[model samples]
Target: MSETNSAMTLGKRSLMGLVLGLAAGGALYFVPECWLRDDFLINTVFKIVGNGYLNLLKMTIAPFVFASLVMGISSATDVRQVGRIGIKILAIYFVTTTIATTFGILGGLILKPGAGLSLGTFELSGQYEAVESSFADVMLGFIPTNIVASFAEGDMIHIVIFAVFVGVAMSLLGTQAEAVKRFNEDFANVMLKIVNMVISTTPFGVFALMATTVANLGFGIIYTLAKYCVCEIFLFFLFGFCVCGGIFTLLARENFFRFLTQFIRKVAMIPFSTSSSNATIPYSIQFCRSIGVSNKVASFTIPLGATVNMDGTAIMQGMTAVFVAQLYGIDMTWVQILTIVIAATMGSIGSPGMPGVVMATLVVVLSSVGFPLEVIGLIVSIDKFPDMFKTVLNVMGDSVCTTIVAKSEGEFDREVFYGRKAAQ
Candidate 1:
């Protein structure tokens, strides 16, 4: 087959997989009692296929992250440039994350969706133990003690730091590092290929995940959490369209909606299905680069953004805290709300990029402010929906941050930023 034809074939297969997966998931929801009663079916086929896909995606994450970071760092001309870019990226990430948390708090305060609601006795699982490490210890730990352990434990932050060091070291060596640089680049490309191969099955993964969630939880949960879900979605649109859009417009002096048009479909899909900023990193990179952001900006910012900056998660944490407070008839002072925002922002940064991590981290943040865990437990059962929306916002924030940084660095194509499509 011609290369073009082969690519098309793969695209078709991916789409077909998504449809089949969704269909299968939907079918499971209405399956006969006997089929549903089979514990093996639930534990084996349904759980395995859905959860297994997530595990496989996660399995590739460490290598992909490190390889991409190595490739990004090696491509940098100097440490000074890397430092400048890194600082800017982190600043944007921190500021926007803070804002996201604030936005959630504001939304929750205004909406008060959980007012007068009572979530009676519930048990919270997965208690997170605080790592006794100090700030210095946390910083030091960013350098992997053992590379293999970082991957085994899914330590994204450590892997990212290690990749950056390798990249910078390779750049310092110049031509002497040619072979290593070439090797890292080749390795990253190969990993990306592997990622593509795995992501082709995303439809199936989404289907299984959705079906299992629907069957186990049922639509009744949505009705119960309808107000909460509505409030959360409102925050998603408000942040994505208003807050983030405003930032991009002020910086680029362009229409934010127009800028979003080109990549909305691509960015929106990953979060809805995968509900992970980390899983969506590959697509975010592709989308940013396509829209004329330089490799330097996209590579450094997007990956780091995925790790440290999750606006959606931040927003969810803040709002959920307020919701819990309201549910328990606990009136939070301004001081308490401010503390929740700070805690949520910090917790999100420290949170790992995995399913259930954000929810757990939010619980930690809320608990710090004396919010009830029982309410958090109720939120957890219906987290998948908000998770999807939050992932979308997180990815969108990354893209916006990249665009602004690229523009400031003179690495952005104004035409493309305002253009109808990303550069080919």
Candidate 2:
């Protein structure tokens, strides 16, 4: 009971912070430069609070990811159960992500958001350097040469690889590894506590972030990228509601609107405001559980989805590739468009769920198709605005996949899904 109350309090306070912060930030935008300096206010004040909160969340992620994956796998009933669930999750991810990428590309081609714009129209900031990485590079990068260095650097791909090995070994050992399993489970609990404490401060952090974002760029930049933003938003809704909702309806055999209402009530705000799906994992797991997903499935799928199932990021990358291509007057062949679809889908896997990181990953997609990297600078400043919405979509994708996998594995409770009974 106390835990439920605490969660409710946090949600209300966080929402208040989001609204107040946006209002405060917008008001600050109107302040004269002489009265309130950007250096003193934005770069110093907002940067410290916002980034500090994010850094706190990042700190929990490494340990949490390691411990949760270890616990999720080690505590499973059987290896075949793990493998079966894994197959289902991956299948859902691939199909939905491919469809999402296609939607994004189609939106870009249909909208032609960049057709009227010239490269000289927008001030492109930062050095746009594309780091070309092939599939072999990604595969090899998954195995860590130095596990210690991987943890220290917060490399999730390496951490996940190591965790899976440890988990599978423990699962095989069974009772012999019981002590180690308990230790990992306890450690995961500790990390969840830390995450909850940090989540409580979300209101303050989001306020600072929104305030700084508005103060720095205001609404002018959004206007410049309005068409591109609109296209992305449209894709998010079309994919989130129509595609994802359709899947949930067909697979879960429940009403999508009902699930959506409960999802919004339980888990939507955190991802929407924080723009970090990793930060929202604990809440997502709870939300899944509330809808009757079992502990084993929820633990494994939500965290794994945090790293791999980035439908939202995939959409943005696909659209951006086409948008940037149009901006530079570079006509991409059908081969290049196909490359964008494949690259975006693969690149989104294991991509860090951090604010504005998509701008960095888009480099790989753009490079694959030989799009102008400099065009990325045109959208970097405004990435944060779209990032919030993208994150909501990202986690919603996670929950949908989690629900479907849970049902397939017989780990779901239909009564809870329909709100006829509370999850126990």
- List model 1 lDDT by residue over 146-182, tens digit each: 9787667655455555666787799788889999888
Q: Which stretches of candidate 1 lie over 4 Å from their true place?
A: 1-81, 119-224, 420-424
Best by lDDT: 2
Our model 1 lands, by Cα RMSD against the true structure, at 9.3
Question: Cα RMSD to native, each candidate?
Answer: 9.3, 8.6
Task: Encode model 2's per-residue lDDT on 288-401: one tens digit a residue.
Answer: 999889989999888878877889988898888888877666666555566678667766764556554465456557655545554443454345567778999999999999
Task: State which candidate has the highest TM-score.
Answer: 2
Alpha-carbon runs more than 4 Å astray in model 2: 1-81, 120-222
TM-scores, one per candidate: 0.59, 0.61
TM for candidate 2 is 0.61
